[model samples]
Target: MMIKPLLLAGALSIGLLSGCATDANRVPEITYEAAANSPFVATNYRAADALISQFRASPDGGPLIVATVVNIDALDQSSTLGRLISEQVSARFSQRGWAMVEMKFRSAVYMKRGEGELILTREIGEVARLNKAQAVILGSYGVSGTVVFINMKIVQPGSNIVVAAYDYVLPYNNEIRSMLVRSTR
Candidate 1:
C-alpha cells in the first residue's frame, strides 16, 4: 500500500514538472549592447529614454547627477561577469548622452548638493551650478537564465524621491545584438 502511494506521488510530481517545462513559457537569452534600439528590447529602452528625458527637461533640477550602481547588495559587482556587464552599462550610459562621473570618489567630476553628490557621467570637479538637478539615475544589471535584466530609477535629489524608473529583462546571445546598438538620441 505504501509503495502504491509513493508511485502515485512520483507520477504526479513528474506531470506537474512537465507542465511547467513546456516551450510556451520559456524565457529567452539577452546580450550586451551599445545602443538602445530594437523592437524586442524597445520596451525597456523606451522606459529608460523617457526617464532621462524627464530629468533633462525638469528646470527645477540642480546639476544632473548620474549614478552607475546603487543596489550593489543585490548584484555581484566583484565577479568577472559583473565587471564586464557594469563596464558595458557605463559605456552605454555615455552613448545615451549621460555625463560620466567618477565612482565613489567625490570631486569636480561630480555635481553636489549638501552631503550627497553625483558620480559617473561627470568627471570630478566639473562645474555646473545647482539649485537642483534635472535628475539622478540609479540602476541594476543582472542575468536571469539567458535573459539580461536592467532595472533603473530616476529620482529627485535632496528628497531622494523616485520620479521615474524601469525594470527591463532582455534575452542575451545572438539574434538580438542589432537591436541593442542604436545611438541614444
Candidate 2:
C-alpha cells in the first residue's frame, strides 16, 4: 500500500512539472524595457492609421505640414517627446504616400531655442499659406497619473476646421519621463 501511494504522488508531481514547462514555452517573457521601447513606433503608426481612416480630403488636395507637438498647458513650448512624436507621426503619414512638407526647411513657422517648429492657433493660416499647405498636423500632450494623453488633429488651413483627429495614451515610464524633460539651455 505504501509503495502504491508513493508511485501515485510521483506521477502527479511529474505531471505538474510538465504542465508548468508547457505554459512557460507558450508564454514569452516580456521585460519592461522591451515593452517601453516597442510602443513608441507602434503607437505612432496606429495614430497615423487612425487619422487616415477619418480623412476625407484628397491626397492631391495639397501638401500636409506637420508641426512640432506642444504641451497643452503651454502652446509655445515643446519637449523632446513632442518633437519626436511629430517626426514619427509625420513619417508614418509620408510612408502611406501623403505629401508631407518638411517644416524645418521652411522659415514661415516660428521656432524657439531648443524647441522645434511651433505653429500657434492664430498663425496656422499664415504658416499654411506660406507653405501652401492644404492641411496642418497639430498635436498636444498632457500628463495625468501614470499615463500621457495625446491629441492630434489635421486642420484645413483656410477654414481652421479639423478634417481628422485622433486621441491616444502612452505609459508614463522612465523613457517617456526623460523625453518630457525640457533642456534649460
| Top TM-score hit | 2
- What local distance difference test score does each model get? 0.49, 0.88
Q: Where does model 2 exceed 4 Å of error?
A: 1-37, 183-185
TM-score to native of every candidate shown? 0.41, 0.78
lDDT for each residue of candidate 1 in 1-185, tens digit (9 for 90 to 100): 79999999999999999988885587555545534444543554465566666554533323454553322444212233233333444455556766544343545443233212334333212332232344566666554557767667765554557777767665766543432332111
TM-score: model 1 vs. ground truth: 0.41
- Model 1 / residue 128 / CA error / Å: 11
All candidates: CA RMSD (Å): 13.0, 8.8
What overall lDDT, based on C-alpha atoms, would model 2 receive against the true structure?
0.88
